[model samples]
Structures are given as structure tokens and as C-alpha cells.
Target: MVDQLRPNPAYIEAVLADAALSPYRTWMGLGITELECDRALVVLDIEDHHLQLRGTVAGGVMASLIDTATFWSAFVRAPADAGVANVDLRVNYLEAVPKGARRLIAEGRCLRPGRRLSYAEAYVRDERGHVVAHGMSSVLTLAGKGLAIDLPKYLEENE
Candidate 1:
């Protein structure tokens, strides 16, 4: 069996910083706080735009959080020349978050990592630690098709 892979500190910092440059991630105010060999933690500070007509957190926001967190959890284990793409995502909204909620915490874990595919799950909690949503995803590991951008250049250009 191949040894499990872990992202080094530099790689972790790179990923966290690069993620902020993504238009969608930036618009959603997503921030990565911690990364491990098989897991990642992300945060979103709620803003007015994140609320729906009902004054609750938008479902789309939660879905995006789940997808992003799950993707990164598996991404850390992929080879340098490989990239993981989400094949399917399923999310369950457990509770509605009040508009006044200060933040949301998302935790994602890779359940299985394979050469061609991977599985991951994630959960979102409000500032009070109430479960707001949960999700699972199937991701395809594409060999010879790594991330399109050069991390160093991307960072420099964004900065």
C-alpha cells in the first residue's frame, strides 16, 4: 500500500492563502484556519448578504462551504500532478442559523483516498456549536491534470 500523504506546512499555508484569491471563496468570505493530513477547518463570518429573505443563513452558502471544505480535505492527499474534482455532493440542512449568528465553522474529513477517487464529509456549525448542516461528496482524482495555476505566480499576482 502506498503511504498516506500529508501536506507540509508550506503547502498548507499556500493553499489557505490561494483559496482567498478565488472569486467565489472571496465573495463568500471563506477562510481556512487549519489543515491536517486528512482534514481541514474553514470559517465564514456571517454578513448581511449571507442571509436569506427569512433572515436565516442561505442554503447556498452552507452548500458552498461543505463543497469547498470537503474538496480541500481530499486535495491535501492528492499527488502533486493530480487534482481532485467533485463528482457529487449531498447536503442536509439540520437547523437554520439566525441572521445574527457571528460565524460558521466548517470541518471536513477525507474518509477514503484512492488513486482515482475519494470520499469526504463535512459539517457546519454555528457560533454556538449547533449543527447547521452536513454533507458528503464523491471526488474524482485526475492524474496528469493538476491545478491549472502556478501557486507561486498566482500568489504574487494576487498580492
Candidate 2:
């Protein structure tokens, strides 16, 4: 089944482009280096704003990275019009990211994919290749509501 889930090149390209253009992804400096049937690789260059007073990467940033990577891992198998919503997310902070680390890499893989739900896991590693955090997520797949879809004009106007 996994073998049959391979994403086409165009779909992969679209996913990467959307990730690059998303406002939140842009703000977080997230970049998608690879996207496959059930796996994804993402990177974030460390910045001052991403750190805490203790000089370590903030937990929220790590969480967001995990979530995004996990979502994409499952999304590669979803219908073009499908959207993903978080059902649950669990993260284990294994070690603090060092202050001097220049970048963080997140590798995510889908454990299972289904019509209504998907499960995925992600590991965040520092530039030194030490795992700083690990995460697992379950997502609800919503058909006919893709992440890349434009919102209604009325909704945008109201906002």
C-alpha cells in the first residue's frame, strides 16, 4: 500500500511551493528539502528570535516544526482537495538545542494513512546530528478542503 502511495513530481512540487509561501512557514523560516510518499525533510536556520532566555530553542518552535513536518508526511498520500487537522500531538524533548547550532532538521514519516485519519512521527535534530526532540501526531483528514485552497472573498473581506 505504501508503495502505491508515491506522490507525483507535480504534487511534490506544489507542496514544497506552498510550504515556502505560507505566511507562518515564511515567518519560521521553514524550508522543505524533500517530500515523498510517506516522508518529508524540513530545515530551519536558527535565529535570535527562535531562542529563549536560557539560550535554547523555544518549545513552541519545536512543536510547530514537528506538527508541520508530520502533517506533510501524511498529506502526501491524501487527495488533492483534502485538508489535515490536528487530532493529537505528542512531543518528547530529549535534549536542549545548543545555542551555537546553526540549523535544525526535521525528518518525518507517516506510520499509517487512511481516508479519515493518519499517524506520523518526526524527529528534530540539531546541526551536530543530536536528536533534540521527537514527536508523534494523529491528524484528521478532511476531504474537499485542501490546505492550499484560497478562502472565499467574503471571508477574507470580513477578516
Instruction: Give the least accurate 10-residue stretch of model 2, judged by summed lDDT.
Output: 150-159
True-structure lDDT of candidate 1: 0.83
Q: Tell me model 2's lDDT, rounded to 2 decimals.
A: 0.82
lDDT of 1 at 70: 93
Q: Which digits, one per residue and each the tens of the lDDT, describe model 1 over residues 72-114?
A: 8888788756778999999999999976799999999999977
Global lDDT of each candidate: 0.83, 0.82
Candidate 2 segments exceeding 4 Å error: 1-4, 147-159
Best by lDDT: 1
* TM-score (all chains, Cα) for each model: 0.87, 0.87
* Model 2, span 1-159: residue lDDT tens: 122366546556655776678888999998888888778888999999999999889999899889888988888787766778768899999999987889999998999988899899999999999999999999788888775634353234333
